[model samples]
Target: MKPMKLMKEIASDIVSLVYPHICVGCGSVMPFGGGILCAECRADFDEPVLDRCPVCGRIIYHRGKCRSCNGTRLYFDRGHSVFEYKDNVRNAVLNCKYRNMKHIGRYFGEIMADYAEKNALCGFDMVTAVPLHKNRMRQRGYNQSDIPAAMVASRLNTPCVSALERVVDTKPQNFLSREERLKNIKRAFAVRDKEAIKGKSILLIDDIYTTGATVNECAKVLKKNGASRVEFLTFSCRAED
Candidate 1:
């Protein structure tokens, strides 16, 4: 091995020894220093049940489409999520979003990639993330969704496209009611290049799905710009019991 490369590896090992990596899901020091979750935490992460709405990806008793989305005019054709937004999974998501633990996003993205492949959800032409407004991007120093979107696109051998931009800097959606969320997010996103997404099937990526307001707004803009279909893949979702 090159002497410089060996020195760098040694330096990294020294840093790891000094500051051990803690699992984002459980706050335990991972036996293996490279990953974000301990094995037990990964195993215990809550997942949604099989019976879910095909359109909204919400947990439902019966198959096909749930009554909530049956007559609703949703912009996205379908949605899929890896875990229910609760417990350790929820903590991991919060860490990824607000705590600057972006490695967790990559980890979750890999999980989403596996889920998509196993469930045959890899038919989209391109993958794009719900873009963050400039103000939010400046405050956070990164768009959390971009990490997972790029990772998923890389895993699926599809192009990751930044085809949308947040034109309006709206308030955070988590504290808002459904009606408020819909109003706040409407007309907030604009397509970057209509020709890039024209008639293409798009897989939109985001970290969480609360009321589906944010992703739906993004899908609305994408479809308006001639995207043939817009589907969503999220890390965690607010599933109804």
Candidate 2:
């Protein structure tokens, strides 16, 4: 090994011994070196049931498309998510988005990559993220979506493209009811490069999938600009029913 690299590894080990990297979920030190969650937390991380709507991937009791997507329609053909947005998964997302635990983002990204590889995200020509508005971007320092997109893109061996822009600073979806969320995000996003996304399959990445308002709007815009297909993968989603 290069002396410099070996020295760096040694230095990291020494620092780790003094201040170990702890799992955010349970506050126990991580036993392995790959991700933020400890082995037990990773094992405990529950996968959502496959009872989601085919179009939105939110849990549905006895149907394919949820009521919203069934009648209203969406540009994105389908959506998939790794875990339900509750308990440890919810806390992990909050930490990743607001608490600067970027490692958690990478961990969730790996889960998404594994899921995509095993169950096929159809034909994603490129990966992009649902953009945060400019002001939000400045406030947050980084887009949470980028971490997952980067990991999945690297694993899938496809290009990661930042092809969409949130032109308007919309309110947090958590603050709004479902009706307001739909209104707040409508027309807030715009395509940045028509040539890049035109006739290409796009996989949109985000931290959470709630009402499907944001992703649906994003998919609509992408399709309008000639994206061949739009699909999405989120870390957490609520029960569709």
Candidate 3:
């Protein structure tokens, strides 16, 4: 490399050791500096504007139940998310899951906790996360959902329970169609401790909600094993066009 380039690299290494650049959204250099996202990009994050279904939390064109959940029997009682899955929020979520940016999970978890409190969504008896199959967990070295679940539980002053387990290692839900996703996740999860969850309301944590297949299947197992109720909170969801 050129002498100047080498000097720049050495300087960057020194700065990293001292200051340590960290921005969860967009990988931008934080100027005013001290949060997950840079100030400008943080302002660009969008919240959902459309009315949502009470049960599924998908955007509804009208004021009533969403068409997606109108005829379907959902296992979870309700669901909600902090941001629409797009732009800076999307980038943050992707980095959190794929790039080992676990701090983003804790940051988003705090935000979700605030949202849950404001919306009166803190009625659950316990908190838990959708479990990864052992093989997948081994590959990833972590179940990404667990960090946020624990953080949210801490904020809510509730116990974070590892109450569900993935019995079958399934295909990534984003790669499948709605029908394929539902079939792919069927019978995939089982309750780890039925006695602990019996008659208890569970708040399930996840990173994103797409077709709702994964969380719904998890809820199915939890409810079948005696959880009195199952509801979910996620970082983002499919945006309604």
Clashes of each: 0, 1, 0
User: How much is the lDDT of residue 188 in candidate 1?
Assistant: 96
Once fitted onto the true fold, the runs of candidate 3 whose alpha carbons sit more than 4 angstroms away are 1-22, 46-48
lDDT (Cα atoms) of all candidates against the true structure: 0.82, 0.81, 0.79
Residue-wise C-alpha lDDT for candidate 2, range 135-235, written one tens digit per residue: 98766656888988988988888899999999989888898987899899999999998998889999999989988899999999999999999999998
Estimate candidate 1's alpha-carbon lDDT, on a 0 to 1 scale: 0.82
Candidate order (lDDT): 1, 2, 3
- Candidate 1 per-residue C-alpha lDDT over 1-241 given as tens digits, one digit per residue, 9 for 90 to 100: 7777577557645643443378788787766565777777778773336677878887667757766577557889998887778778888888878875655666777888887788887778999998999998866657888988988898788999999999999999888987899899989999999999999999999989878888888998999899999999998888764
Clash pairs, candidate 3, are none
Assess candidate 2 and give its TM-score to the true structure.
0.85
Best lDDT among the predictions, by candidate number: 1
Candidate 1's error at 64, in angstroms? 4.9
Root-mean-square deviation of each candidate, in angstroms? 5.5, 5.6, 6.4
lDDT of 1 at 186: 87
